[model samples]
Structure formats: C-alpha cells, structure tokens
Target: MVKIARWNHDGGTQSGFVDNGNCYALPAGQGVQSLLDAGLDETLDLARKVTGSATPVPLADVHLLAPLVPATIRDFVAFEEHVEGVRKSIDGVAGVVPEWYEAPTFYFTNPHTVTGTGEVIGIPAGCEDLDFETEVAAVVGRVPGSDGRNLTADEAHRHIFGYTVLNDWSARDLQRREMKVSLGPCKGKDFANTLGPWIVTADEFEALHDAEGFLPISMSVEVNGEAIGQDLLSNMGWPFAELVAYASQDSVVRPGDVLGSGTCGSGCLAELWGRNGSKTPPPLKTGDVIRMTVEGIGTIENSVGERREAVTRVPARSRPRNRVAPVVTAGT
Candidate 1:
C-alpha cells in the first residue's frame, strides 16, 4: 500500500507518496494541498510519476506533519460498546437512546488545533486529568453532488480521499465539567488533536473493508510504553462511509474536511475505568509519550508538553437593578 505524507524536507514541508520505504516529495514548499487542488485524476497521475522519478528520501530523514491541514473536522460517536462503557461512568445514565439508532451523533472540533504525529502537545490551562482517544479518520475529497445535493452513502463513499489515525486528546476533568453544562468540550478538547503517521490513500485500503465498508484494522494505544488496550476496528457499529454520508446531509462537506470514526471500544482510559470498575489510571503527565496505532494506518506518537500557566479568574459583578437586557431592546 502506498502512503502519502507531508514532511519537513528540502528546507520546508513537502508532500509526497511513500513507496518502497522512501518518500517521493512533490516539490519545495508544496504539500497535499497542492495535490487536492490539482483534483483527483491529476493527483493520482502525479503521485505515480513522482514515485518513480523523484529522488527517494528514506523515511528516517523526513519529519512528517499532519498529512494535511483539514478544512474542517467532524468527530462522531459510532461505537456502541464505547457508548455503553462511558454511560456506566456517569452517575446513573444507562443504555443508548432511541435517537442513536436513527442517526449518527457528532460534534465539530477546532480544526486548527491539529497536531501531527510525533509532535509535542501541551495540556490545557487548569486541566489536571489528561487522556487520549483512539480513532480512525477519513480525509474528504470533492464529492460529485456535495454542493447542490445531499449525497447518498454510495456517493459519499467515493469522496473519501484517504484514512488516517486520530488521537482525540482530552482533558477529562475539563471535558466532564463542560459537557455537564451541555454546551462545551470547547476548552477541554480544543487544545490539540493528533493525526498522522500518514494518510493511506482510499485505493490502498478500501479493499480490506467488509461488505458494509468497515475496515478490519486493529486499533491500539500505548501510554509511556505500556499497552493499555487494543481492539479490531470491525467492532465499530457504524462504518466510516456512513459517517461521511451523514455529515454531508443538509450541509456541505468540502474537500480536506476530516470525519472521524469516534473512539473504538475500550479505546481510552475513561472507558477502561468504567468497564473494569477499577481505579482510573493517573492522568497524563508532562513528558508522557502516547502512541496510538491502527494496523495499516500507522502510529501517532505524541508527548504531553508542559502545562501553561493558569490565567487568573476574574470575579463577577452583580447586574444593575435598572440595567436592560439585550433581549428587551430587541423586542422593541
């Protein structure tokens, strides 16, 4: 299988296809963006040519970046086992709602906060409980009817440009607190998400998936160096093509948008704790390296950087008795 990667080489980041354990770079300063901009047929043609003519750069010398900076990111919760496991962690919640069966549930995250494999990421301010989520993500390409029509699952499946591993890094303390308010996960999850090792072009791996388009790769996570857990990706209840199709409904999903497969069962510390009823492992600490690997997709190895200094809290002032709220003015 050919792997596409963008790396720090020849003075700046260059994108290319990897074959024979060597990188065939596009050009100085150009990256996957150029390929996507060139369109599908052209990109494939260029990839083929470069792999043969370009000077092969051994994988060791290249510093890989996030395969490409995604235009947007949609992370969906599609694993039933993960859902059940997490529910048990809650004070009293149990079982999936009827709505879950009808449609996929998802959330938008900060696309700009993406961190590539091997990069160092820092903990969010005020966060003490850090965690990692193991997931698989698909990079979107131009779908035939993306703008004017809602594409069916078959059409959406064609738009998948490739797949990559995703580490939806989290600050559990902040996550639980914000999610309680039902409006956030903003500050908690926005700090950083890890993606990479590289993107395996759709053609390379799609054949491995089953009739329903569920790829049968093994997903695993290692903290510091201990194997936390691993599971076959086939266990996910919803296939990624369905997730992409769901995202395209009533909305436009542009090329470079990343749609994730949520976390696999027992993919994170939270689910593990909830499942075993054992003590939750200590949160990630500075200098901790986490390697989350998905068979065929490659491993995303990242370390927790230093925590930022906490910002001082501003005290709240009571509202004036005569102050008019914005809603009152709008009524006029």
Candidate 2:
C-alpha cells in the first residue's frame, strides 16, 4: 500500500493514506517505509481494511511532504517516448542517439532540491520558460550488499521500500541554453525537485495488472483543470528491478535513496510539443497550477511563482597549500 506523511493543522506530522475524499492519518512512523519494514505482504492487506475514521482531515488542511527524504536523487532516462518527445521538441534533434539504447543513463541532483506538495516553487530570476516532468520514483528499502554484491530482479523487489510521485520541475530556457556547454543539466534542473503527497508500497496493487500480466499503475496530470498527461506503469522501457540493478552497478545504492524513472512517455514538455524534430513546447507561467496523479501514489499539485532573486550561497576559500607546494619542492 502507498503511505504518506501529512501535516496536521497544528503543523505536526502523521502517517496517512490518499483515499476517497480525505487523508486518513495512520499511527506514528507508519509511513510507506515503516509499513514496508513491517512487511510488504501484510501491511498492504491491512491498509485495505482501514474503515473511515470519525474525525477525518481535509486534504487541503494538510501539507503534502516528500515521501522519502533521500540522501541523493538519482534520475534515470528510460522511456523512449520521453526521450524522443524531448528530441523532437528541441530543434536539430530528430533521432535517438544509439548510445541511449545501450543501457540506462542517470544524473545526480542535490537532495536539497526536494520540496513537498502545495509548496510554492520559487522560480530563478530571468528564467521564464519553466516546465514539469512527472516521474515515478522508487525508494530504496534495504541497505546495499544483502547478497554481498548486486541484486537480481527477485532480490531487488524485496528491497523496494515504496513508491512516490516525483515532479522534476525544469527551467526550459536555461536548459536549452546550457545544452550547448556539454556539461550536465545543472542550475536549470537543480533549482527544484518535488515529491509526494505520500508513498505507496509495492504490495498496494498486488492485483492491478497490465495486459502482459505485470503489475501496473495509472498516471495522469492536469494543469489549471486541463488534462495534459496520462500513462500506465507497465509501459516503462525498463522495470523497477532493472533500474535497481543499473543503479547498483557499482554497488552504490543505499536505503532511503531515490531512483527516478525519468519522465514517463507523456509526462513532460517534449511529449506535448512533439520533440522528435518538430513542435515547440508550451511554456508555463505564473499562476498555473500543475497537478500530477499516479494510481496508487496519490497526487501532487504545485503552482508557478514569480522569480525571486535570493542568492543563498556561502563563499569558498582557496587553499594556501596549493601555492606553497611549488615553493616547498624547490626548497627541498
């Protein structure tokens, strides 16, 4: 089952569920992680039996926070549709790079980029072309090295703590400009990343299946009341297990870390704009509310805000040792 940590009116946190009309707070520390730790098979069965509580909390009354405060955010470029859409939207990229099909590609985003649902995202100054990416992020449940090496599909599934909805918000203008530099997607991407209203465990949809008999979840997005994105979980180019294996290639994955399945096929700017070689993407502006929904994972709604020029940074110090190194060698 999916689990979430919601804020009470008094600004306190509690475990919750995203059900019919409202969020029902569960017992303390009983979030998706806690439930998975308890037992994936049993916890989900228990979740289905929860009846309506007398005192229910309105979804609006509570703040949705990131399901997992991962130590590091590793995002993978998996879906061909998403990649093709992106290439087509931007000029000059009309075909897929052969290297992309070789294996999964990933990039690291600072963990601090994470924000909760309903929080106002502060746009960076001079950056007007903002965009959204809807992704399904898997939380690492177990510590690495269970088998003393990498894990297979069967072993990897047991390590999944839970799942959550992730919005990899973007600054398209900055991204486009930066693409020419040969560096990774940085400031344009580092600005902000969003997670949960809640987290859903693997067991939640034991019965939900795709046409191929694989477990599947439904996903969709809405912007200012208009439907903009939709897809099924089974359509991912690679499944969670393979993603885990790719992420753990060097034996680096750890618990509480997040692995994002980059934007789903129709989950980003490229899809709507036809990024394969044609189409210009629609830009987001202030006051636009983007809401994303994943079948068992719940919804995350955020609004664009005016860019604020708050440069929160600390000065870096140069080392005197570097300058003295040459002098020391000569003296010696």
Candidate 3:
C-alpha cells in the first residue's frame, strides 16, 4: 500500500506517494484532495500508473505539508480511559457520564488552522496551559455520485480514504473558562490542529481489523524526546466506522472531511494532570517538541512556537437586568 503526501520541493508544492524512503511525484497540480475527489479506486490506479514514470526523490529532501486541508473536522471523545482520567482531573470524579455510552460525541474544530509535521504551532495569546492531544483522523473519500448522509457503519467504512496522525492542540486555560459557560471549547481549541507525515490508505489496515472492527494498532506520544504515554487504537469506545456513521447522521460527510478519534487513553497532558492530581510533568512551554506515532500509519512532530499578543479583544457583555413582568388582570 502507498502512503500519499503533499510537500514542498523545488520552490513549489507537489503531491506524491512515498515508498521505501523515496517519494514519487504524481502529475503536477493533481493533489491528494483532487485524487480523493476522483474516487479512491481511480486514485490508486493513477498512482500505480505514474510510479514507474515518476522520478524518485529522497523523502528527506522534501518539506512536508498537511496531506490535505479537510472539508471539515469533527473530533470525537471515543476513549473511555481518556474520558475517565480527564473527568477525575477536572471534576475530581472517576466515572464517565452515562450519556456518553448512548452515542459518540464530537465537536467541530477550526479546519483553517491545520498545520503539518515540522511546523511551529504558536500558543494562542492568553493561553498559559498549552497542551497537545494525540489522535488518529480518518479522511473521507468520494463515491462519485454519492453525497453520504445517514450512512450505516458498513457504508461509512467504504467512504473512508485513509488515516493519519492528528495533534489537536489545546489552550487549557482558555478552554476551562469558555467551557464553564457551556458553549465552547472554541477559542480554546481553534488555534492549531496538526495532521500528517502522510495518509495511509484504509486498505493497508484491512488485515489488522479485530472482531469488534477496531484496528488494534499501537499509538504513542512523546514530549521533548521523552516518551509520555501509549495506547492501542482498539481501546476506543467506538471504532472509526461508527464515528463516521454518527457524523453522517442527518448531516453530510463529503470527501476530505476528517473525523478524529479524539485523544487516545493517556493521549494528552490534561488527562495525565487530572490523573496525577497535579501538573507534575508540567504544561508545554514555548519550544517544547511533541512527537506522536501510530504503528501502521506514521509519526508527526511539531514544536510549540512563542505565544503572540492578541491584536484585538471583545469587551465583556453587560449583565441583563432582572426585570419582572407586570401581570394583566383579565385584559385590564
């Protein structure tokens, strides 16, 4: 199976497939997103046809970019262990809410903020508790005439193009304050979300599926070269297919739509801090490097950049008056 990639080489961005430590360029201007829009089978066929004619470049020579900018991104909380850990950390409680078992839940994140491996992720202004979330994101493929909605698990599985490592960077201080109002994870999470190394086609994981439809692939995270935690993909409360299907319920999931498997068990510093009862490992600071690896897919590493000052700010809202309504006595 081929690993699809987008990179900068020769002062221009190009799309290609990487194999055996080399990258084979596809026809100029035909990017991973366009290939996926053309449909998965056709994309694979074209890659095979072009491989022989394409010149090989050493993988190290090219600068990688996010394989594709997503149509939209929906990140789900699918790991029970992660949920339990963070809940305890935040609320000083130990169990997941019962509602979580009834259905998989997710939130929309900023797609425009997506970055790739080796890039610098700037910590958002006013955010002192910067953190990284380790996740696996499924990239949707097109079915030519079909726009998927209300799909079954099996149908959703077919629309999946591939998987890649995702770093859903978080600004915990902002997230905490915003979430207290119960309307956000918004500004807290919108700053930077990283994807890539490359996209590994879904077919590559065919032989690894477990009876429960989970991949069982190993996943891990490290900070500043120190290994932090590891967990299996199979540990997810719901598999990728279910997450995709749930996302398509009454909504549309188009090609290039990304569905993230949230943070895996012990996948982020917040979860660990909650579990340990303190920030023993400490929050990420400027220049801290984060590296994440998924066994079958690949690894993505990014450095935290200096926080920048906000150019503008919104004024706080005024509190509403506690006005009482006058009662009308029979239309008086």
Model 2 segments more than 4 A misplaced: 16-60, 143-149, 209-215, 274-281, 310-329
Better of 1 and 3 by TM-score: 3
lDDT pick, better of 1 and 2: 1
Model 3, C-alpha of 118: deviation from truth (Å): 0.2
Candidate 1 accuracy as lDDT? 0.81
Error of 3 at 275 (Å): 0.8
- Model 3, 91-113: lDDT tens digits are 67888999999999999999999
TM-score of 3: 0.94
Residue 108 in candidate 2, Cα distance off native in Å: 1.4
Please report, as a residue range, the 10-residue window in candidate 1 with the lowest summed lDDT: 142-151
lDDT by residue (198-284, candidate 2, tens digit) is 777766654674444344778888888988878877777777777887777667566667888888878876566764333344678
Q: TM-score for model 1?
A: 0.91
Query: Which 10 residues in a row give candidate 2 its minimum summed lDDT?
Result: 274-283
| lDDT against the true structure, each candidate | 0.81, 0.73, 0.90
Q: Backbone clashes in each candidate structure, one number apiece?
A: 0, 9, 1
Per residue, candidate 1 scores C-alpha lDDT tens digits across 1-332 of 76878888768778899887798988666678666555555677788888889999898888989998888889988888887776666433667767877889988999899989989999888888788899999888764434514777887778888889999988877777778877866787898988898888788776798988888899999998998878888887788778887887888777788888888887888776677675367678999999998888788899989999887235578877887656556557
Using TM-score, rank the candidates from best to worst.
3, 1, 2
